[model samples]
Target: MKFIALFAGLPLLAAAAPTQRALGMPLQGDLCMPFQHDLGTPLQGGDFTAFAWFEHEPIHPPIQARGLRFWVGGEPATYCPSPPVVHCPPGKVTAFSGGGYGLSVMVPGGQRVYVSPTGELGYTQAHSAYIPPGSFLGPFEYTPGIPFGHYTFNGKGFIACPNSKEGPTTWKVFAHIPNAIVPTSDIQDCLPFQAVTEIFGSPPAAWQYT
Candidate 1:
């Protein structure tokens, strides 16, 4: 049961400039423009991968958090949308019954983040992980106006384990900023994990056309 890539051809919408309050500073075009990044393969013990991008929203009232979208393999995880569960063992019951996988996060600001597998994955409780009280579970905070910065998201994903009795294995998940080195202390101590959305910055040149 390998996952497919469903977001391969989505259109890239134009984004507007960030407000002074959003970046804490100002001096350029949209710093946090809608962007996408490849969430390389799972750490070292999983069979699935993911990718993410920001769905741009009109600048007004200032969106509390940018809408982030995630596409796991090609189909949504059991915790996500209508896709059936991937690779569930013959006689084991899954922790979650929606059919996709489950994604949970521990960002700053004491925010409890839960990512539902609705084909497109986003924060259910806190829309965006931007703000002092709500860091994206990493080493950076969301500074208004300065929409460009790196951060890490720590969480877990329940997926099928190839050679184990654990029907839907729980793997530690980490989404990090590009080239960002996660301190050993920041690492979550959990098993059967996978990481997604590696780097988030400006949209790639290739996305300019879409």
Candidate 2:
């Protein structure tokens, strides 16, 4: 699996320059580029939106089913924090616990969907599966850019990208994590993989601004 060159033939943005920003959940890491998707034929000329739906149950006592829905584009949607925080910054990405297992995108024709690599994208890291259920954590703040790598929550991992690059779009999962289990339908979109680069040190050279 090889990744399309993220910085190929692109100008790097200055570090100090203000990046174009949009309000949404903050992802765990930076975005990757040249992201490929298998959501059927591309839209002719109209804009489309992506969405992800997640569900799982906690392992602790008194387990309960939890779910979350996230959207990329369309009419403005309301995001009310579970507990209204009075001092959240203007651009803060709200964080949360309990991750999601299923993923889907709403394109022009209909919704394109995908389940977790193994089972469900879990929340905490104390699980027995490759992708722990309850792993769909975070509403962290993120600025849009070319899809990049992902972040870890308590050692559990999930790829993070802008709403546009979510669902039906994936890098080489097996290449990065050799034992990773991917659905046959998603394999077509997994090739040309790029080695995952940690964004905690520094941001990538190129990214598409919102």
Best-fitting candidate, scored by lDDT: 2
C-alpha RMSD by candidate, in order: 18.5, 18.5
Question: Given candidate 2, what's the lDDT at residue 110?
Answer: 22
Writing each residue's lDDT as its tens digit, candidate 2 over 66-139 gives 22222211222112223444332221121211111111111112221122334222221111123333222232
Count of clashing residue pairs in every prediction: 28, 28
The whole-model lDDT of each prediction reads 0.22, 0.23
With candidate 2 superimposed using the best TM-score fit, by how many Å does residue 91's alpha carbon deviate from the native? 5.0
